[model samples]
Target: MPSPSPILLAPMEGLLDFVLRDVLTRIGGVDRCVSEFIRITGTVLPDRVFLRYVPELLNGSRTPAGTPVRPQLLGSDAACLADNAAALARLQPEGVDLNFGCPANIVNRHGGGAALLDTPEALFDIVRAVRAAVPAHLPVSAKMRLGVRDASLALENARALAEAGACELVVHARTKTDGYRPPAYWELIAAIREAVAIPVVANGEIWTVADAQRCRELSGCQALMLGRGAVADPGLAWAIRAADGQAVSGAVGWTELLPQLDAFWRIISHHFPGRQRVGRLKQWLNLLRRRHPEAEAAFMEIRTLTDPAAVDAWMARQRA
Candidate 1:
């Protein structure tokens, strides 16, 4: 039988950075991860910029837990993106991912991200350029939404990326206008899968093992990518694997999750400055509250404190 599909961690810009990737991958069950989009605008960014966004590049492009990370690039200029991809390739990332799926207005307004979804020809050019620039052994992939305003051009866009030599395609089952609302249209991914020859991974709104199973059923995709859902419950990937009869542990209860939270705090404290530290903890606690009641209480307790030392003391108390 074919091997079970891999569970990938989505590259959530601003939310899933290297620190969180370290924590979650340490929790186990993720097969691979895509780093947040490194915007390639007009110029070829310096090595520091790529290393800043994905420090894993310094460690052989693998997280502290040893999971390979593919750095994703977002842009509209085919030549500039190609140049940036070449620079990033020299850093030896596991792979390079092209982002055609970000829906942020700031990104769209600049004619990047999901804005390229409106033009299949642009998608073709961008992916083709990046693919040609990177070494043949290194994989080049693309992630895209169903379309911009609607699904009318979804198939065309998928075909363009596939024809342009994208090794794999991740379809985030919603149009640009759909935003993050419910009902991620997994069935639409099925159509995109049918249109493309490469592996199509389904993404969007998969919060639990049940959602994962249902998405697999509807999209006819074996692979699923987790985003906010994984952030809320770091063990979601492990739980999904266990549900599939893999010899793995299941859900990480609040008590079991505390250690990982502590680790997350410790890393951010060392890497981020005092001013940004507490907000990073709060940002995660806000999402953790979605899955754990204890996190709600923790969030409320530290919600008012701007002092990093106060947050540190509070964390120490929790560990106690």
Candidate 2:
């Protein structure tokens, strides 16, 4: 590993919110975390949106636990993105990251996220403009896929991004067509790393500490950005940091997991009280489904409970 370790929390839009970020960073090993993409279409998003996600900017550019939290932006208009970058600079974040990798239908259709990759010329112009807007001390980085459809354009796209003055790039190593499927082919990240001048962070399919190690060795990039892997096991970062032969944390059974799960809902509940709270819980449950069979049952129970207390009770009963 590279000194303190090189794991970063991926900039997952809805999933990597403020509280979730807090939880993961506290896990001992994660060095950096990027807030969900702040969509800047032209209008400057309110300060609350920035502080709500990037509270770290308030205290020197690093998250409360000391790991840096870079704010990410997603949009198509170069001028708008440049303006947004300039505006956010006043906050003095450690860095700003460009989101050229989001595959969401809404973002793609608007030509804001991954859709820009389809037009490499536009992508080049946007990155160059944003680089010009941000201060030299603050790094401008990017996260991208191999291509929108197949992995054909990965090398060329990576070269264009690097040549455009981006400080570094994180290659997710899969085409947009792969979505979040298996076999992320981290080896492709090695190819991009060799092709670029700046540091390349390897992302995708890193579920365990061994996986991270293998990714680094196979991709020749020790820097890793965790997406779903971090979501499934929030303690992963700390484990990776310890760098021991032992697994960092133990698996919680349904019995022991209920209280922690219930507590998380409470935190989310505060932000989204009532219907707002319920919606957030549902979204989190969707991620839990991949790791917990009872997540489906808990989600079904919570879907109609409406009452937060009742939802907690139902979730508790899901214990194995």
Candidate 3:
């Protein structure tokens, strides 16, 4: 078979701020990045929100380091979604990603996100509405989990997205009921892939290059989308591209690690302006904690450090 394509980074709300996005992209492995969902409830999302989440639009679809970054929108109202999509298209971001897949309860309770799966007709309506509004050349895609409570409606829902003009559909395999807790059913992704003719991207449970390889073979997907896995190992897509069985092995050096961490802090620091630096770093450090068990000591060491001076001092001590 031809070489496997590069992996796309699945956006995590709050977790994927401009700082983290920049840091990860500069690490040189992520294929494409999606901005955190610009929530569009019934109101059209403001251009500032779109620009804030997807600065890559200003940089020609690439992250600060030049990796493609697509803007994503979350909303239920079809016309509002279409209008926001049209406005966002003005920036020429890669494409608009409709988030019918987010299973967050707050989003679901609002009759948006995965709750739309309960009414696949509505899902089709949103997809069709947005697809029709976007320029003919621009691509539109939808991301979704299996369904509300079970797999019974997964195929039908997947097909609806395709029939409604989604250029591609990325399926997370498990139902919304499964949420992030995994044992992600790649078989279901395979089922969805087979159910629709549009390119299907498999997501979930892809923690390592080996898992991605196996998932690609199992799901028979046109591409793979990495979520927490990429967050845990920033070099994941690079390692997978190299096809090294030990791609999961540490390619990140301590020296390289600091710069990326600094970059993340820089963006957070910029956003929060008056907010405490230690607190900013701590949020990312929490996610980074999942990868480095030793980060427990690091978190404890810096937990109380609020300002930049304290944060700088704490890091200095840790390095020493």
Sorted on TM-score, best first, the list reads: 1, 3, 2
Per-residue lDDT of candidate 2, residues 1-320 (tens digit): 33434778898876787767765565546777888998877686777777777777888877656778889999999888888888888899889999988888888888877777777777788889999998889899999987899767788888888888898898887777787888888887887889988999999988887888888888999788888887776656666665654355654444444655666676776776776677777877777676678777777767776777776566566543
Top-lDDT structure, candidate number: 1
User: Cα lDDT of all candidates, in order?
Assistant: 0.93, 0.78, 0.79
Could you give me the TM-score of model 2 versus the true structure? 0.84
Cα misplacement distance, residue 162 of candidate 1 (Å): 0.3
Candidate 2: how large is its RMSD? 3.5
- Kindly list the per-residue Cα lDDT of model 3 for residues 143-172, writing each as its tens digit: 998888988888888888999999888888
The 10 consecutive residues of candidate 2 with the worst lDDT sum are 245-254
Which lDDT tens digits does candidate 1 get at residues 73-144?
999999999999999999999999999999999999999999999899999999999999999999999999
Tell me the deviation in Å of residue 245 in model 3: 8.5
Error of 3 at 104 (Å): 1.4
Tell me the spans in candidate 1 whose CA falls farther than 4 Å from its real position.
1-3
Clash pairs detected, candidate 3: none
